[model samples]
Target: MLTIDITGAEVLGQQGFHRDGLSLSGGLIMDAPVGRAVDLTGFRVLPGIVDVHGDGFERHLAPRRGAMKQMAEGLVAAEAELAANGITTGVLAQFVSWEGGLRGMDFADQVFGAIRDTAGGLVTDLRPQLRFETHLLDDYAGLPARIAEWGVSYVVFNDHLPHARLAEGRKPPRLVGQALKAQRNPEVHFQMLLDLHARRAEVPAALDSLCATLADMGVQMGSHDDHTAEARAAWRARGVKVSEFPETLEAAEAADAAGDVVILGAPNLVRGGSHKGNVSALDVVSMGMADAVASDYHYPSPRRAALMLARSGVLDFAAAWALVSAGPARALGLRDRGVLQAGKRADLVALDAADRVAMTVSGGRVSYLSGDIAARLVA
Candidate 1:
């Protein structure tokens, strides 16, 4: 057991911190009498960020064209980046697509193995959230088994190919460029995209089975890019309580009405636009349509996005912070984290005025401080 006091820090969304201290014991926070504490005057002490969706680790997975990095190295670098970005509990969105290339099943297996092995020792608390492409229905049967064995925290259904089918010839050149950069043959990719859409009749049955299996196993389920109220209703019926990146205002509203947690990308809020030409996150937040805002592919955006939303008057600090913190935590059913309450796990971050991470403490132990390792525990 260890005890330290963080005093004079502003606790976001709460009454200003008294000139007292926070105490940690047995890896859980305990209230103690106020005393002379380490003064953190002028700084904000927020609950550690709980990032439900981030794929920035992909940068390390495929650092360059035709180059494959080792999972251990990528995990180390990814953990460092997450800490620097103020993410304490990070759910890396590992895409196990049917693309049949570097971003496919083998890569997912390796990364998932690394995540399971390295999670306890990493600078940040790392969890694997599988981003499953529905067209990968051929592999769906085995996923529940794998998730049961591996213990994944979250699962999101990505139908990028469905949207691509909708775009077809009107597809932007940048998307094509991205495909090429990933070493995918354009014709083959286009054919597969078309084939996936043509096979839509098979999707609902496969997805229903998969969702039911995961629900029975107590795994969290999320639907991505829901475009219509009907689409949202269908997912809701399947026990998919999370709506990720709803593409239309109607979809978001419908999810809200259905008591689904609507998750938007933090990058969309920070950039003030969506990369895929969907509904803007700022608009969603202003309309009270968003429940959680994830980092998505950009690890640093959630904290900055929270501040940006506050400054833009879309939400007050408490409401904006909830999108990145407690909202996502509750969405995933994470019981012990995402808030700075007494008796909770002392997972927290110290942030400067610019919303940059200065220190990150995970599970009552300092894991990362700025650019250095604050605590090193080997698993």
Candidate 2:
């Protein structure tokens, strides 16, 4: 297709929503109209959702909790779902954790490799995030090299070791099933967890070294589910600048004080509180500390959360919507999309007056088009 003049829609432009038509040619937004036009009357155009942290792709990759034999097809299917949700760019947050099955390092290898090879051909930009277990001391030395080899730039540190249970010399609940899924001997896996717990005291130093090396390599780093000011401070010292879903007001406040990007789950925003009963995302947003809202597990929440924020009067439409688009793009240092301006990537979502996504375009390609708007564009 040549340059398309997207007319008669309330496009969220640099200055906010306007009826001025948008044009895209050569996979980028254009200053002026140059080709055929479509009247998207009663529709709203906004920057495509940039999912900062999401792992919903796991369903596509392992619907039954087992790896799909055809990884590439799974990724393509995942892209379709993303585009349908108005996600022009999605960060597939994969785990390299002690937990077995799809989250293990070996599966991370497969997932990252597939993303690197398959994402280039897809319309929706798929980014890879490595969620590493901070207490996995054995994996520290080669982590940077492995990240580079996997072509992944974003890494989040997490400590999900169930320390209290292990310290009590108890097997964590569902231990046997988890080990079975990972194809590990249950007793051996329990021993491994115990050993990892014993080394909890060493994580700080190990993370300090590993994160420094990753920072030197320009890899974006984040700390996950922080619960205290001290914990957030510790991560900041290690060059981790993004606090992913801080679990307390103290942690979120600490991150804000240190100039770190604080990401909250969109589900929390929609539900009015964290599902895990931690800090409320709305409370954090009300305090002006949240940098972005992400689709942590459900792909639809970012859009809904932004709309909800707008309706709740915490922010105007543009500002609320930016939480899903520009804010996330900024968190990942992606400058191409998020804002609908001339010379930027023409990534946007067109929604009906009812707020249903009618069409989605990524880099000038129509990744998704449906409803009456399809006829308008075609006609």
Candidate 3:
């Protein structure tokens, strides 16, 4: 364990700014000093961002098609980027879906195995969130065991099928491109889709059964792209308490009403709206429907989004920062990190006057240090 004392930097916690600064020792925050004090003037210290869900690392893992031969190297690069952005804990969303290649079950096995094997070497606390496609009915029976084998605690159900076209008994567009990407013949892929669609009526029962088993195993569950309040309610009944990126305001509101955490994309806020023309995260934040915001496809968006919210007067600094820190931490049931306080995990980030990440400390270890901050620490 490492001990560090950061002084002169304004410490921001859930309550507000602490002028007295703070200290870290043995991987936890300390009330009294246990290490040499370093003056971090002209900086602000806040809890390191807790990203509940993010798939941005996909590019690092598979930057180009057929370019990835190993995951360990990619994961290392991903952690560097995460620490540079002040993310202490990140949930890497890996897919186990009908779509083959990177999103396929075979690839998922490689990812999960790499993560488990590389856990000891990781500086940042990286966890896996299995994004299981709901239509893979055959996988339902074995998923619980596979999740345990992979040491994954979080699972999110997603249905990426073109529901309107499928419901109309029509083949979804882009079948050839999708098949080529999945390394399958277009005709075979089309047949697979049709076969899966025909069993849609049986999906609900299978999903319910799987959710119950996961609940028994104490795995946290969530649903993605919920489109309706009724759909949100149905998911809630199956013990899926997290609503990730609800496509409609009504769905988000319903999640809140049921006391479920509503997660929105931080990029949506940074860009002012959803790229897909869905409900705006800014609007959801304003309506008090968003419980947390994630990086989504961008590693730096969480920090940028939080600062933007504060600068725009949508929320005060403390409240806005919470959307990325405490809010996501709590949503993911991570009680140990996300807030700056005595006895908590010493996962802290130091930002310069311009709000750029100058130093990041994860578990009391300096994972990233830059500019004058790095020079000062070295000296």
Candidate 4:
């Protein structure tokens, strides 16, 4: 096993920063001497980020419509991006939804197969997370076995349908375009949507059953885009404890009060607010309601958001940084690799003066090394 000692950097300790730096050997932080020691002065060393939910890899996987040909290549590219962004453990949120195309069941199988095949070669710990659309009742029965086959331990429930308009008998905007993307006739797709909408009352019971089955399988589950406290409470009753990207403060407070983890998108923080005009992540963080932040659709946002939070003076570095590191790790039941302490996994990222990742080490193995940092290590 490779050993590396990173010195002359301000390492993040349990309370705050430590000026003495740290050492890594045999894939864990250690006090004993090891192999090479790289001088990383003028840098800040912290735990590698753990992204609990993110779909940014979709662009790399498909790039363009009807263009996906290789999953392994896409996964490799995604892993490189993750490592470059200081993410050691990334939960790739793959959709098993009604949107069809890349988000459909067939494509999800391909992604799962490719992920399993590429797992051994990946430097970052890439985990699969199923974003299941609640209205896909037919898919629910087979999900348990499918999840087990894919080695997926995390699942998030989503309902992206425009229920209000559909209930009013209004066709969804761009209905024809959506149907074409799903390879279905516009009329047929509209009927399908209407049929699902009519059966809305059945959804809760079905979701409860599905959640029960998933929980029995030892899968961690969360609900996405929670809009109300009542909706969040319903999901919570079914054992879906994580509230992902709640759109209202009441919803977020409900999750917090229930002791469920509240996850906001990192992009919301970096962009100053939600583009969809939902709740502000900054407000959630300030109120101490947000427990963690995911990269969501942007790979670079986690690091930038953490730093930005500190810059805004709303949170100290330790508290702000934990949203991307320790908080997310703990949310996903990963008790290791999110802290820069002895006896823990040696997964750390070093940021240069410009706040870019200068180096990233996952499991004491250098996953990303760039610019002057690479030269110093080589020398």
Candidate 5:
């Protein structure tokens, strides 16, 4: 691992920023100086981002039809994007949905396998999260075995079947587009969706069973797009403690009341509200109903969201940044990183005077470096 004594920068610690130098050696932060010293005078060093929920890697994993033949190389590229954005710990959310194409089981198999096999050669801690469609009752039986086989410990349940529209016997607005993406005939796809929707009554028991099985296997479980307190409670009863992007204040407050982790989308914060017309992340965070902010679908939103939150005076810099760092780390059950402390993994980002990501270091190894900071590290 690369070792260095970094001095003069505004290093963020448990309390706040300090001018005291930071040291790294053998993939761990050191209590004192080690190896060559580097003067990072005008920079601000912050803990590496730990994105607990993100599907942004989907683009890199399969940019277009037949675009990513070599999946491992694609993962490397994904890690590079993560490193560039100061994310050392990134959870690449893949779906086991009926949507097919990138979100289909076959593609998910390749993605989870590639992450398990390829991330060892990459710097970022690329973990896999399987987003399983809740209405897939038939697939629930073998879900645990498949999850273990894929080496995925984190699973989130999503129900995106357009239940209301289907129940009304209305053709979903995007039916044709969804069929094209899945490469199934439109009528066939509609029928398949209707079939899944018709079995909605059976989903609850199936999910309860699946979540119990996963919990026994020591897997982490979450629910996506929770819209009501009752829905949040239902998930909580299954030992699914993380609620990602609760679409209503009722759901978010329910999570808070139950001591469950509430994750809001960073993109929502960046956009000033939920683009989908749901509850605002800022509102939830302001009321202390949210615990973490995730990238959701955009890799850069977490960093921007934190900075914007700080500037808005909703929180101090440390607390706001923690939503992206320490907060997510806690949600992911990772204790070794997320903070700049001796004996912890040496994961940190150096921001220039302009707050640009000048460099990112993961496990004491330089993952991304650019601008004038590169010359200083080399000197």
Candidate 6:
């Protein structure tokens, strides 16, 4: 193992003559003297990104309409892309919905199997996170065992059932179209929603039971796209502390006030807005409402988003970088990595001027480097 030292990088937004050298030995930072001999004159070293929610692999898995890559090939490709984007640790958000289709249980099984068979062996540490739709209660029983077997670190619950308020005045045609797009038969989906509403009182109890079960099985829970303080509070009460993609500023604020880590998508920050027409992540960061950001879909967004947030004066480099690095790592309960601190794992990335990943070091090994990775994989 190489004992390398990174010299002269500023530490986490602190100013004035703050130059430190990180020593890496045996794939982890070792306690050693900052030798004056090493030369790192102009480079800025940041921790390797820990992306808590990434769905880009879904695209790669089904690259085009009616096309799908083989599971192993997709996993390899995803790992390479993640390393190329400076993401050392990534949670692949497997969307498990009740409406059976591409994003449903069968797809989840393929993904979970791929992840289980090829986790630590991959270039980047790929973890599976089931993005469970709350209405998919029937799938919950099998999930706990899979989580335990695979060592899934995160679970996010999403309820995208059309709001009762929105449904009241909507035309049937429009509702049908929306339901079909969500991969549900229009009548079945509509009936399911109505049935769900009728059993609303039991919904929370069922969700809470599932949450407790998952927690008991040692999986961290997160709530996704929470739209209200009440919704946020309900999730927090269920011991789901990580709030993923709050749909409104108020919801994000509530999560922050409750001391829950608020995760926004890096794509939102990079694009300057939300794709779902939710709260602007830049605005959220400006208001100090977001604790972390993840590459929710696009793999490159996290690094670029961090730089964008820093350059736009929304946050300093350290604080912005934390959103992609330490913040997500901490949220996932990963203490071994995510910081350039003395005892952390030597998972680091070197970026070029455009904030593109030039090289990625995972666990003290050079896993990917600029053209080298793309060259090896693409051929």
- Name the best candidate (by lDDT): 5
TM-score of each: 0.89, 0.98, 0.98, 0.97, 0.99, 0.86
Q: Against the unseen true structure, what C-alpha lDDT does each candidate score?
A: 0.78, 0.91, 0.91, 0.90, 0.91, 0.78
lDDT of 4 by residue, 1-85 (tens): 3476777888888688887758888889997657578788889999999999999999888998868798899999999999999
Worst 10 residues of 5 by lDDT: 57-66
Q: How displaced is residue 266 in candidate 3, in Å?
A: 0.6
Clash statistics: count for each candidate? 0, 0, 0, 0, 0, 0
Candidate 3 lDDT by residue in tens digits, 33-115: 87687888889999999999999999888898878888899999999999999999999999998898899998899888888
Error of 1 at 204 (Å): 1.2
Of models 1 and 5, which has the larger lDDT? 5
Stretches of candidate 3 above 4 Å error?
Answer: none
The candidate 1 region of ten consecutive residues with least summed lDDT is 370-379
Comparing 2 with 5 on TM-score, the higher-scoring candidate is: 5
Mark the 10 consecutive residues where model 4 has the least summed lDDT: 1-10
Off by over 4 Å in 1: 13-19, 33-36, 65-69, 162-190, 371-379
Model 5 vs truth, CA RMSD: 0.9
**Candidate 1 lDDT tens digits, 1-379:** 2356666677654432444556666667777733334656666778889998888888876687557666787788888888877788888888877555556787788789888887777657788888888887678878888886666868888876645534464443455665675568777666666666777789999888889888888888898899999999999998998999999999999999888999999999888899889999888888887878899888889999988887887777777788888888888788788777788888877776666787777877766665221221110
Model 4 segments more than 4 A misplaced:
none
Q: Quote the positional error of residue 339 for candidate 2 in Å.
A: 0.9
| Deviation from native of the Cα of residue 140 in model 6, angstroms | 3.5
On the 0 to 100 scale, the lDDT of residue 101 in model 4 is 80
TM-score of 3: 0.98
Error of 1 at 32 (Å): 0.6
Instruction: Say which prediction, candidate 1 or candidate 6, comes out ahead on TM-score.
Output: 1
